[model samples]
Target: MSGPLVSIIIPFYNDGYVNQAVASALAQTYPHIEVIVVDDGSTANQHLLDPYRSRIHYIGKANGGTASALNYGIRMATGEYIAWLSSDDIFYPHKVAGQLGHMLSRGALISSTDFDLIGAHGELLKPQLAVKFASAADFLRALHTFCPINGCTVMMHRSVIGRIGWFDESLRYTQDYDYWLRVILSGIDFHFVNSPLTAYRWHDKSGTSRYLDQVNAEFGIVHGRYVHGLNGLIARIGG
Candidate 1:
């Protein structure tokens, strides 16, 4: 089979640290990537992205949320495969190439890899393992316990996006988790790459980490929709 074209979608808002993220995607060893950076109504540090204007496809939109920005990128993308990267994260040089190779070989609809957690100073803090879900049921069962896939580490076929639909724009946090649940419920095949392919920065200033309660509430909504709700409970206890 021919190599697939991967669209890397990044959503940012007033992130002074966006340069590293953009540089990493631009530096990917995979030559078939199209980098799309969505500016989520960022007012401060707009100049931070000026250096990458020629290297990336930049889009400016109202600050609805990361989900809104990502949905916009998806609509504008023309790639056979799509991947998401956070503005605060950086991918290893060979991340795209390695993940793309695995997805093509396995014919995986959606795939993700392990990643390293880095501190604000760029020191390695911890290594996160990529959670593997054997089936849709397995994924639903683990939804409330932990996230089955890391959003930034995911690389999925275009068909998967069409089947699962777009990210939930209503979700300000845990949008990825909500999307993953929908994908799992649709019964798409998923896989995990054993190697660490990206660095997820953890700092006090990061949005998700700073507003953990909101994140938790959003996660609860997803779990309630899929597990604790009428349909979810029926799926679990009935079966």
Candidate 2:
């Protein structure tokens, strides 16, 4: 750990894959970083994390949704920037260095990279789908139909959190999409790096797979908050 402090916050439950998640963060090529793991009330498998006790800041909290766990970690983060990793996902070794460099070069408050999709056994699933937003207006336009950013691929400045505020605890499934939409809507630019910097695990046990119906329903509620608002935003940006 060598440059500016970057906080890698991993929120997990009883998933056995968590060790890989923390290991990926620990192996980041970036020199300076702090790894914080928030255990969201796991009933068992606590022993898996024992080996990393001295290597990370661990917090065990009562069973709450992912949104709650993330907010707790963000509040406790002491880094200039934050990088979130899912318990089952893996970050490319160059993830932090690559995204941080892009943010600094583009003067962006938040940035996300393209990512590869992997199977439960770490087998390649598919190449990354490209995500690009010319401006906030473009992002909002797309949100009318789909989420344009991957939450795990994000590396955002600490002040970006201050500007946009924390994740909405009320949003149980689509919280990340809701948060990203809010970030760009707050007049802070969101940038993208074309390089793939993370491996997105697509296992059946992943939240989306287990709660597809809930996520879809929650998306309706979340996107509604932007429908009328996006029209005004587009007008202001001359889009």
Candidate 3:
């Protein structure tokens, strides 16, 4: 059977590591895949994407932020499913194939896999984070404590945007977590694949490290909305 087309959207800003990021998307074992790279006003790194000009669909936009860039790319994408890949992270070759299979087998609209935390030079960090949720209460409990889904490790049906809309443009950080919260609250059930399908890069210069304060501040704002609305939400999340 033919698989649905999965658009791997990479919102490119920092030019330094985009090559590796794009390369991984192109290497996906899944055949029905399209790679879309959105250049978010990175003048210095624009040239780095020149080599892949003939391969991936590229979009050039002003420096709004990661959220805006991803929204733009999604708007321009023509695929049944959408997957976000960070410009600094690496998606394993089986990432798309594995997640896509999981979503299909489970009849799920969204799926996310476990990923490894790696250093700037690609050295593995200790203790890979794994996801397991037997019930909605379990998932909500995990979310109430910390984000269980990694943005790059997540794949959702494009139809979800019609329900939850785009990322919150106002947020400069933690938008992924915010988006996931919206997905969960919108009565959407997500499947978690235990396979490690991506590597999340952590470094001193990364956005999470450089803007740690802003990330924390935005995270507080994102989850706080749901915390107040958690009274009867567990049932909707279960299915």
Candidate 4:
């Protein structure tokens, strides 16, 4: 099969470190890739993105949260496959080539690869599995146990978005987790590449770390939306 067009969507809010992330996408070994950077009403260091303006498709909108930014990016995407990258994360050179090759070869709707955790100083912390689920049921079973999927490492077919709809704009956190639940429950096939293809950065100011309580609350909301009322509540509590 011919290679597919890959769309890399990034949502950022005043993240000065976004250059590395944008560079990662632009440097993908794969040639047919489009990089979309959505700035979520960030006023701090807006010039941080000026260097990449000519290389990437940039959008600036009011701060409506990551989900809203992502949804906007999705609507504007014209590729056969869509992937997301957090503003602080970095994709390895072959991330797009490897994940796209695997997804096309396997005819899978959703695919992800392992990634390395990077510290603020750009040191590798550890490697992590990119693929968290082998099937729909497995994903649902592990939903509350742990978040198996990583947003930045995921690459999925455009049809998956068509069927599952866009990310939940109402969620402040766990939006990707919520989207994964919807994808799996909708019976889409999931696949994985075991190689570490990206760098997931963990910093003091990162969204996941800065908003733990909000993240927990959003997690509960996702669980309730997918796992039914009583069972989902139990799972969230048990988790």
The best candidate in terms of TM-score = 2
TM-score of 4: 0.90
- Computed on alpha carbons, the lDDT of every model, listed in order, comes to 0.85, 0.88, 0.86, 0.83
Which parts of model 1 are misplaced by more than 4 Å?
Answer: 128-140, 228-239
Write model 1 residue lDDT over 1-239, tens digit each, in one string: 35779999999998877888999999998898899999999998878888889989999999999999999999889899999999989999999999999988888888879898898977899876556555655655666676767899999888887788889999998889888877766666567788999999989999878898888877887777877442554386443
How many angstroms is residue 190 displaced in model 1 relative to the true structure, after the best TM-score fit? Answer: 1.6
Q: Report the lDDT tens digits of candidate 4 across residue range 183-225.
A: 7656565676888998999989988899888888878877776
TM-score per prediction, in order, is: 0.91, 0.95, 0.93, 0.90
- Candidates sorted by TM-score, best first: 2, 3, 1, 4
Residue 175 CA displacement from its true place in model 1, Å: 1.0
Report the candidate with higher TM-score, 1 versus 2: 2
Tens digits of per-residue lDDT, candidate 3, 1-239, equal 58789999999886588998999999999989899999898877777878888989998899999999999999989999999999999999999998888898888898888888888898999446666677768878777767878889889999899999999999898788888888877778877888889999988878888887788878888778888555457555563
TM-score of 2: 0.95
Clashing pairs in 4: 113-130, 114-130
Residue 117 Cα positional deviation in candidate 1, in Å, after optimal superposition? 0.5
* C-alpha positional error of residue 66 in candidate 3 after TM-score superposition, expressed in Å: 0.8
Candidate 4 stretches with Cα past 4 Å from truth are 129-139, 229-239
21: Cα error in model 3, Å: 0.4
Ranking by lDDT: 2, 3, 1, 4
- Candidate 2 residues lying further than 4 Å off, grouped into runs, are 132-138
lDDT of 3 at 165: 95
